[model samples]
Target: MAKYLPPLFTRLYLSLLTAIFASILLTFYLSEQFLQRSDVVDFYEDSLQVFIDVSSYLQRNGQTAEQLFKDDTVLDPEFEILWQKNWDANADCEHCKFLSVIANTAIYQLSDEQLLAVYPLQQSEEVILISDKPANSSIFSGDRRQQNSSLITLFRNDPSEFIPYLLLLIVIISLGTTLYFSVRRLQKQINQLVKVNQEFGRGELSARAQKNYTEPVNELAQSFNRMADAITETVSENQIFAQAVPHEMRTPLSRIQLATGLLRQRKLKCEELVLLDNIDDYIDDIEKLTRQVLTFSKLNSISNQCDHQAKQCIKLDDFLQGRIKRLVVDNNLSINLNLQALQLECDPAYLRLIFDNLIKNALQYAATHIEVNLKVSPKNLIMLTVDDDGPGIDNLQFETIFQPFSRLDKSRNQETGGLGLGLPIAKAATRRINGHLFVSHSHLGGARFSCQLPLKVP
Candidate 1:
């Protein structure tokens, strides 16, 4: 079953809407309760005044309670009078009391859903007064009583009675719509920030979040941009340092090579010649190290600018054959190639750099033979592999070897004249063209450098 998860803004909107609706409902309920209580208190005061008026009328006329009751049955317009002589005969009325206490006036509900107020006459003989319409309808059934009461019957029967509820509905809809758009705007900004952060994490150091000062999220965007700036500056400085150190060392290396060549030309003993050969080997190692460092730094710089770099559709087969032929002449190494006539869209300089590093690394380590294979997949992906017949790399070193300045062993470094930057430069060059480079155990009992690149330019 798929979990029902909502987005952050959606959850926030729902929670806010629910809180608002509940608050409005609670306010309405409490206000209705307060108004009902106020109405009840006013009705009690009016009823007490009416009772006092009846008592005053009997005293002003110089008449007794029994004579006043018999003469005038109706006392006020708001209430009716009922003379009950044998009230004890009714079992329900046995517990009923005279008007000696203010609580004696009680509300009586009839069988036909009508409300009646029953009050004692406060006389010698037992008598009660009743009212068909209570002093306040709210005293009985709260606001619901006003719905059926005669006072609001005309309003309820009219069509316009729905106006208040209709207005309330419109207000709720307007609030919801406003919240929706506001949340959507916030979500869009947040998504943009997230996308930029993801791209930055993926090594696009130039990626930055767009800022809008009018928005609240602009503060976050500002912080993100600052962080990106710091990281990009740091990486650029490091690349500059890497390139600078190599360029400074190259001059001394060239002088050392000249001195060693001149020394080797002198007539010397066998042991002395061997010492000169060792010096020559050491010079070659230093030269190789300088070249690798320069290439590594250049690849790092180019990868950062790959987006604006020009790319060309180059024939892969012809390109590999020319590069292999040149390497063969330089290193006197036997290399086999199985390349297809496929066109690839990439920076030709970077592509040649990638192949040169891989093929040179293979030739350096291979005992007898090296193989280069290039093919296009069904998905239009270019796959290139370079394998050798030397001892394969340890599985653990597959990733370690691609790190700059990483070496498997000191002996291998000395024998191969490598400063462990060939594979790293190759990897960087592959990435410049939106490609991946990885190494695995080759079928020929050696390391296999595999590269996958998209045929279509990105």
Candidate 2:
């Protein structure tokens, strides 16, 4: 069976509230146990003495307690006093409980709310004294509880019993103990999974979740392992193919070049020379494709050693000025550059590669104008954009353009097209520094590529 797992924050918050509630109940219980009440003695307890005095008065006056009760005399207590002769019958009323005997006077608790006393007199007769409260308080005549609070005490259940509170304490303790262990166990398991995921994200392809886990968690871990396995396998195969193809093609390309050189040295017709020049062009394109394949393979492969600098902080204005000055741009195209003074944290080499690819891509596609802008966004991220004034790409092809060897313009002419590794390499560099790359329609009537990066490398 799959175990129920609550959200992490919800469980933590619920645990906190439960802890507070348990603490409050425990504090109330402990205070009630150790702290004394304000009223040490109530009126009912002082009335116990009244029972003894009434008993004594009956014995000395030579009067029966039952007779004293019939006559409204000055000896009558302000409290209710019960003087009954039918001891066996009254005992069945559930009102009598013998407490203790002092000086031949016996005390019995009556009806939970009153006290009684018995004193022996002249003829083996006994006088019973009961402290009076109200008529509603007395239920000494019924076998069952009061039905209407008066019909028979049929509704009576003592409120001072301790068992209910004891039961409640047990329930709270049991629930609290269960919740504590459950949340603790779940947190430990979640932390283990999160740790392995973090290791995998940090380029540790070997990191895998252990099988010693319960349902749902183990199931999710297995899914992640399967995905990682597929990625690792694909990357390994691509690397071998990219490296091997270039090595294999080098021999044929070198031989063809040598043959073309020897043919150029002899006298040749115009058409033959044109054919030789076409062969040279093909060789050059092949060599360029081979180098790009190897670069694409390296970029897509997962590795920790990126030759990234430990201190990633760099001045944006100086870096841009130096790299742009070195680039060989077309003379006819009008270039507009807008820059901001910013100190950014990133691997400068990776940033340089991304910037160079974007600039080259824009230069290749622009008709007459190119715009480059660098600034910081409101989210404290670095936003760098390159815009061109040429035929823009369709919005649907935005994701497709990032794939290696993808080209929108079907014409494979080298002048206007490329092997299409530039954007992919740029995207890879952006991901390495934990950044986002997106393409959209530009205000300049052509394509716009935007790179959004965090201030710090992560």
* Candidate-wise lDDT, in order: 0.73, 0.74
- The true-structure Cα RMSD of candidate 1 reads 7.8
TM-score, model 1 to reference: 0.64
lDDT of 2 by residue, 1-458 (tens): 23587776566858775776777678777775453221112333444467657767877998777788788765543566666664552554354665556566555555444555454444655555444454655536443232335522433454445454666678777776777776667677788889988887866677887777777678887888898888778867877888899889999999999999999999999999999999999999999888877776766666665545444788987887777767736798888889898887877867887888898888888999999899999998999999999899898999999998789876666676787888998998888778999999999999999999888776
Work out how many backbone clashes candidate 1 has: 0
| Model 1 misplaced stretches (Cα beyond 4 Å) | 1-7, 10-15, 29-167, 170-216, 302-309, 316-342, 356-398, 412-417, 439-450
lDDT of 1 by residue, 400-449 (tens): 88898787665535555467777788898888777999999898888898
Off by over 4 Å in 2: 1-162, 198-202, 211-223, 309-313
Give Cα distance to truth, residue 97, candidate 1, Å.
Answer: 28
By TM-score, the best candidate is 2
